[model samples]
Target: MPYCPPDCSCNLDGTVDCGGVDLKEFPRNLSESILHLSLQNNALEVIPMEELSRLQNLETFNLQNNRLTSKGLPDDAFCSLENLLYLYLANNKLTVAPKYLPKTLVSADVAANYLTKIYPLTFGQKPNLRSIYLHNNKLTDAGLPDHMFNGSDGVGILIMSSNFLKYVPKNLPKELFRLHLKDNKLEKIPKGAFDHLSKLRELYLHNNYITNDGIDNETFWKLSSLEYLDLSSNNLTQIPRGLPRNIVLLHLEKNAIKSIPGSWLTQIKNLEYLLLHNNKIKAKAIHPLAFKGLKKLHTFHLYNNMLERIPSGLPRRVKTLMLLHNQITEISRNDFAYSYFLIELNLSYNKLTSPKIHPEAFRKMRLLESLDFSGNNLNVVPSGLPKNLHVLRLKENEINSIPDGSLSGMTKLKELFLSNNKLKLNSIYPGAWKQLTNLQLLDLSGNQLSYVPTDLPESLEYIYLQNNQISVISENAFESTPNIKGIFLRDNRLTTSRVKEIAFEKLKFLQVLDMGAYSESATESKKDGGTSGDNLENDSEQATQNDK
Candidate 1:
């Protein structure tokens, strides 16, 4: 029967909750036997030290989202709670690390504060401390004492990102498993900065100013357990030498790197994801055997570069290859000769035309699933696409016709996007989509169609035919497709008199039928009290909500 505060709730398990009550001061008459207390999301400006010291059995303290300042927190605010294991003082106005923290602290989150410095003995002698989150602070390199974490042998994760540190902090705990210093001003890594952190697994240093000359050759060679490293958005002109051989994921995008040496990554056999987009990498600068030994690499992103053709030696086991937004004009037969496991390939926004693309360019990718050839200059659909493809995007091209037998083998195709092309109703061959039994969506919007194309797949669920010159939808236009759910024929020349009610009679699952903005003359006919035009529009609207 312990006394609970008037505005708070108390549990029999020694937990008290008083968060988000617009509390301006700490609640009184709190049970001394309480083990957990929450006072977050309040305007608590000061912590009454003498009053809080009575709760010696308290193990977790949360004062996050308060107005606690450095001067208000006394030197012995949290030192008296001998059993304090978790402390959360984040989103406060503290200008320095709280001093005299109990040695029993396991995790402390002081993130999103105005902390500018950490005293020498702030986290020095805590052997049980494992995590310290001080990100989004204003701490500089000089503010972090060299021996800040001197005696803390068990500190594992330290997040100091979005700071103003100019150099890597020295004498870090040897048992660190993850360190995040991204969004900092780090310019150099002193020779032995990370030599002692043998158990470090992930290091994030992106959005910094680290150049190749500033990184010592042996800086990251001693981290045997390192697996993920991000050096994106930096000033490096080339790939830094002496990266850990066992790393799995490497991110080097948004750098000024121009060339990748042949032997740079030959030893990292465990690499899986490599991102090098938004750089100045040219096709000739990539050595013939640059990516020869990466067997486990599945995702490679080299888009937004100055490459005229596909690089010679891509990873053989890559499953997703993104080479869009480049100067690539053609795909030779041998470009993807060894990529047998590729599933998704995007070659959009390149200078590729139909004649420049070799017929056998994509012949070896039998397992391909999604192919995007959009934003190109092709007069017809490219041949030799994989039959197992499920999604194909040929939008924003000059494609005027689909040659017969071009898509007859792709039985598993599901979605086709041919919007914003020069396609007309007569340009599509008869039964062009006859073999596509699994097709679900067809997008032919922004085309030059005067009539709806016939012989659509029966499995179609959605069709987009907006932004065309279609003046009439034949009575049996959708007779072949019965499972269609949505039809977007907006912004066309469809009038009320031309639309027959029987055209949409068989679509039982239809939900949306938007025939946008009729002419003023059509609306005048409805105003003249004609039931023919009004009934036809009303019946089509009623069909959209059938069987729901």
Candidate 2:
């Protein structure tokens, strides 16, 4: 009796659920005690194989995403499923690598497919073959043949990422442990290419064209149970002299790496996230004890490079320090004297200038929280920072003034960028932002201001003040913020009769009022739709008359 094909599903333990059923073929009534068969995502282009060779007690044969090819799989088609153990032909259109695989396969997903050749005894010595997903396929290196993973000694995870392999893939499989050759045209790494794997552990080889004399100083000296090593972007100019001290996250960013040898940070002293950003690093070729013995390092990116300072013996439990852009002109006060659990400090752009900061610079960080110092050439606002700051960017720079207590001990400042710079609404001072009071976003766009800056801080909610020359909108200018909601003041020199149309009627939860070049008198005061609260008529005057 053969009766379940209305988009199949015959169970009772002898499983046979036809998955994603648009079944173009193969589902023709078969229940000879099915053991487990899921024809996955089926527009089954042709896998009839004499009706699946009479399912000899199949044991999990999921034909994954099926437009099955290789001329419809014939010669000894899965050789009568000798009680197969998981063989999902992934993505499908397979070119070759499926010569009836079934030495009771223990996991074989012919990944993504179009497998440009793989012949030499394609899985012939399969003794319970363990995990082999031939990643994204057009695999090169002459279609892999020299002892094609010799007699699979229980191969363990070999995902050949994005192929065309220019090297390293010979006879691998001494029980390999995760070898994903990321983005391939792999340029030379043959010295015992992980000789006898020693149960390898996560080695990605990021982006590939691998250089620096194509790797040989004892390859990786037999991977001592490696732990995550990405070798980012590749063309490697240095730093690859047998790295394998049980590495714990070391992605060498972008490349051209100019010198790092402090005997390579004394061989990764259990490195904890050390990503050398962008590259060309040239601060007198490093080595002031080049990050002295990592000591459980915690995130240090060294962004952009050519560093003109700040690289002295880091790793006092570093907590995120991305020296953005570089040429760092001065930050001394024992420049981060032993990290002290620093928290997020990105010296934006760099050639910093506010008299090179030395008033006890950041005074032992105190668990600092987000301090960027955008662009550079700073003119002020650099007082001994770190009062548990919560984001303080200082955009562009040449800052002219904000004087009065320049942010009296931060008080957990909440995002303050001070846009473009050389500011001048009478150079700020009258309680300059009144001790921030947990200020909520205040950019002060571009610069050369004409007004708007008196004791602001009732926890203001977003105020950018676009471009500048602001021709007054005073009169209770937001009367100490009723939680103002976004007021940008686009382009500037405002008009609608120089602003007092109830100057935003005490904001009332205003929602975005941009007012670019006075938006045609705020669109004729919203076409004269008169209403109370001093008549500028709601929604922040239709958001400054639909801010165009």
Best by lDDT: 1
Write candidate 2's Cα lDDT for 1-548 as tens digits.
Answer: 44677867787888878899788888765876788889899878777777788888898989889898888887578888888888888998988776557677787888898898786556757878888888898889887788775667887888989977889878687877888998999988887868678788888989989997888777886888878889899999888877777788889999899878777666777888989999988767877787676788889898897899887777788888899998989988997877878889899888889878786877888998888988988887777778888888888889997666667878788888878888887777677686878978888777898877767899888777766777768778878888888777666666566787576767778776665435346454334432222322234443322112
- Model 1 C-alpha lDDT per residue in residues 1-548, reported as the tens digit of each score: 79987778889999989898889888876878999999999899888887798899999999999999998888789878999999999999999998778889899899999999898767888999999999999999878888999789799999999999999998999999999999999999988999999999999999999999999779898999999999999999998878888899999999999998999888788899999999999999999888888899999999998888999888989999999999999888889899899999999999999999888888889999999999989889998888999999999999999887789889999999888899987888788876789999888888999977788889998888877878777789899989998787765676766777699988899877766555445455334432232232233442222111
TM-scores for the candidates: 0.95, 0.37
Question: Between which residue pairs do clashes occur in model 1?
Answer: none
The Cα local distance difference test for each model comes to: 0.87, 0.79
Report the Cα lDDT for candidate 2. 0.79
lDDT of 1: 0.87
